[model samples]
Target: MKRICFLYCMIFVFLLMPNIVGATQSRDDGLSQFMFGISYNELLDTGDIRSHKAEFLAGEEIQGVFEEYDTLLYDKKNGYMELHLDASPCDCPGKITAAAYAKRNGGYLFLRNKETTCIYRHVNGIVASEPITSYMPVGFGLQMFLPEHFSLPKNDEAAFFLTAEIPRQGTTTTLQLKQIPFGLYVPSTTLLIDDAPLALADKAKEVEQINDPQLSLENGSFYKTYHNIHESALIFFDPEQFNDEAYPTELPKKELQDMLLSGNLSAIGEKDRHILEKLGAYASSYPPITLEHMSERFRFFYMVYQVEQNLVWDTCTMEWDSVAGRFRITKKWLSRKKPASFLEFLRDADFWVAAC
Candidate 1:
């Protein structure tokens, strides 16, 4: 009878021990409890997977721009949260490399890292880690610059597997987000076209009356030529600062600028032409006079469509006339196709021509 009484007391003590120690075991696998904050378009997620999976435009927090030198850039927002994982004190501060991958085929995308203040560990049914009290906020933030040219089509959804790997600890945790759509922006408007497509005749008529080359260039500017020339020159001078891969042919600075600015494909060789084509496919810094007032519409151009990689002949060119101290469209090309405004000729060439 005394032995039976002692066994009952021990069972009662075991149940009360959990309450005495400030720990709770909601689940056997602690890693499975992670939650992510996914921001789509302008909508913010409250660190809930169900909230993230809801229908919404993704990637408003990330923006892509074609820089002056034609190198693509993606500026991403920091402060994405990974919440509810166990963290414990350890001898070494473990580092985590988090990356986004294509969920369908498991293709690797981009990864970034942050050091963990404490190691996360789970043994049996209990999480051997620091308890996140009600006073403390759960989870940590992650931020990384994805590949410069990485793009996903507008409205086309794909699954993104976000994984955090702690190499030192030999542990990896993954959470999958489905139906993630990416936003795209192109440097040159002509990239919207295929096969040296000609601009529509009717849209060409809109700017036929504007004859001043300076005003004409601004009215229907091709990609930002002046900035492109300036940036290319800078890249050639300071390769460390800017990507030198932009200019593959390796010409002298003045020559490279002149070759790009000239718009005379006959003057430059095949490789130089390839460089020109690549630079021309991105959006220009200056929007056409038509789109200058329509800021929202201009933004739409960047958020839709993939860029084509060919140069159409009707594309405009601008050269600084030192004597006049202003930019002028060269006579050789425009004169050959007289009366066709450079802007109008390139106008319908845009893929968004119908929508615009």
Candidate 2:
């Protein structure tokens, strides 16, 4: 089964053929900083290439509260900067347009996740353009940047670079990027969320505890559910799209239970980091992650509130251990046996800042 999945992943890569990959990729011993690149199919005849120009303004403001994308930044100002391509004339589909590179050692380190995760449309302040319909899958080598070849790290150096292929120099869309600070508008002081309905243990107890999952795919099974979140106030989890059964009920952990009962989301992240990681990357062959059945083989399960994507998932895994006779939670692995979650894979301090 794993062999088949491996072949499938290879085929998937072959199909995309990635005009180029590696710049955005990290070595098993290295890390990947977010890089953006723009590319255009080069002209067939000319060894000569045209030049395009655009400018990015730093510190632009945006208003709508979007997830993941809400946090934005510039390369240089935050100790991160784009790699200078020198704009040499070139002709090829593989040619790069523009890219963002981490400029400082602090910038390149995965623990420092200083790369941009999403772009926002500036309307007074960063606002949501639209919910992303697609995501850049892992193990695909951060699709946009081109690989950089050089000796070991520099004395005054950041190790990674990002590159993009720009269209013929005169194209209408000139490349302009800005590094901005991310500010979350949670109405922190003025408001509080009502997680009360969700923490009702009595109601949860009334619901049957299942030994099986609600859905099982080649990747894994649906493990848990997001409780008390409304179909309306959320960008994801529209009731119209999913039915009650698709969202599995979880016996809220002590941390979440307290938050639900108290209306405070503070420090809730401190205790359940493991569960959160599982929720983010648990395998699912299905798109948009819909699970449909259950089984005892799918015992260990949990859910996480994904602030990055403003989405949520219930991670289900068959892997578990009993330490000294009590259930011991261990990190889950994907079908390929790669570390299953992004948070698990990266384990960077910056990610904790952005994600937590």
Query: Which numbered prediction scores highest in lDDT against the true structure?
Result: 1
lDDT of 2 by residue, 190-288 (tens): 111111111112222312333223222223222122210111112112233223254332424443433433345445453343333233223333222
- The deviation in Å at residue 250 for candidate 1 is 4.1
Clashing pairs in 1: 186-283, 187-282, 187-283, 188-281, 188-282, 188-283, 224-284
- Candidate 2: give its CA RMSD in angstroms: 24.1
Candidate 1 lowest-lDDT run of ten: 119-128
Q: Give the TM-score of candidate 1.
A: 0.17
Q: What C-alpha lDDT do the candidate models reach, one value each? A: 0.28, 0.22
Residues 176-208 of candidate 1 have per-residue lDDT tens digits of 111111111212221221111122222333223
Native-structure RMSD, model 1 = 25.2
Q: How much is 307 displaced in model 2, in angstroms?
A: 22
Model 2 stretches astray by more than 4 angstroms: 1-33, 37-72, 80-107, 110-298, 302-356
Which stretches of model 1 miss by more than 4 angstroms? 1-204, 208-243, 262-265, 283-356
